[model samples]
Target: MDFDNFKTLGEWDKWKGALAKAVDLGEAIGFNENTVDKMAYRIGNFLSSTVDPENREERVLQELWKVADESDKKVLAKLIVRMVEKDSRLH
Candidate 1:
């Protein structure tokens, strides 16, 4: 589904939709209910600064590790990486 090979102009709409959904999910996660948006925003912002383009997975994991307990940090790291990778693919 490379854009260069697109037949219909609208074929790339799916990528756009997915990108928007991913970003919105990230924003909502940033606006989390329990932790307050500020806390989550800080987390989300930190992830973005350190892991944009989905590079530096270990660095991202380490940063998350410092802030979160071991079990929760592992889970959070996976979710955040997925979100980032998804964003990279779509964008």
Candidate 2:
């Protein structure tokens, strides 16, 4: 539940699990994929703007976000959602 920890997570599987939990929370609140994706974008924006990357994945995402247009950021957010979804299914 502590989102700040996400930035610092070094293990990919742990990070993926955290995100999957977030997706589950969104679903519990009745958010569909599109809505969750949009929410993910907002969260991504906040992280990119306000948080320093504490791990390679966060650093990579922040780097990508820096060069991305708004449309591409949306795509990135959706891809993140899909990644987490795919990971969640394996557990």
Candidate 3:
């Protein structure tokens, strides 16, 4: 899928739902949490570099991505993964 399309998706909920579906698919495919989280970071890097932030939260993440060193970027990625997991549970 063209990850860049996410920028034009318009709504934050659409972005969140798409990400949740991806997470569900990864789990269904037997990818462990660690691998999924690693991939999430790579995806995050791609988005941060290629796509303009589509919302306030995404803009904040973009700002953080711009300033973060390599190690901290990994942390940010993990945090995002965890947030997605928590959100899925809540809804």
Q: Which candidate should be chosen as best, given lDDT against the real structure?
A: 2
Please give the CA lDDT of all the candidate structures.
0.50, 0.89, 0.85
Residues 1-91 of candidate 3: C-alpha lDDT, one tens digit per residue: 9765575555776677778888889989999999998998999899999999867778999999989998999999989877777778888
- Which regions of candidate 1 fall more than 4 Å away from where they truly are? 1-67
1-91 per-residue lDDT for model 1 (tens digits)? 5755453324334433554465567666673333332343455556545753322344555566567764665466446545654655655
lDDT of 2 by residue, 1-91 (tens): 9876664664666777998999989999999989999999999999899998767777899999999999999999999999999889887
For model 1, the run of ten residues with the poorest summed lDDT: 31-40
Comparing candidate 2 with candidate 3, which one achieves the higher lDDT?
A: 2
TM-scores for the candidates: 0.28, 0.84, 0.83
Error of 3 at 17 (Å): 1.8
Q: List the residue pairs that clash in candidate 1.
A: none
Backbone clash numbers for all candidates listed: 0, 0, 0
Give me candidate 1's TM-score against the actual structure: 0.28
Better of 1 and 2 by lDDT: 2
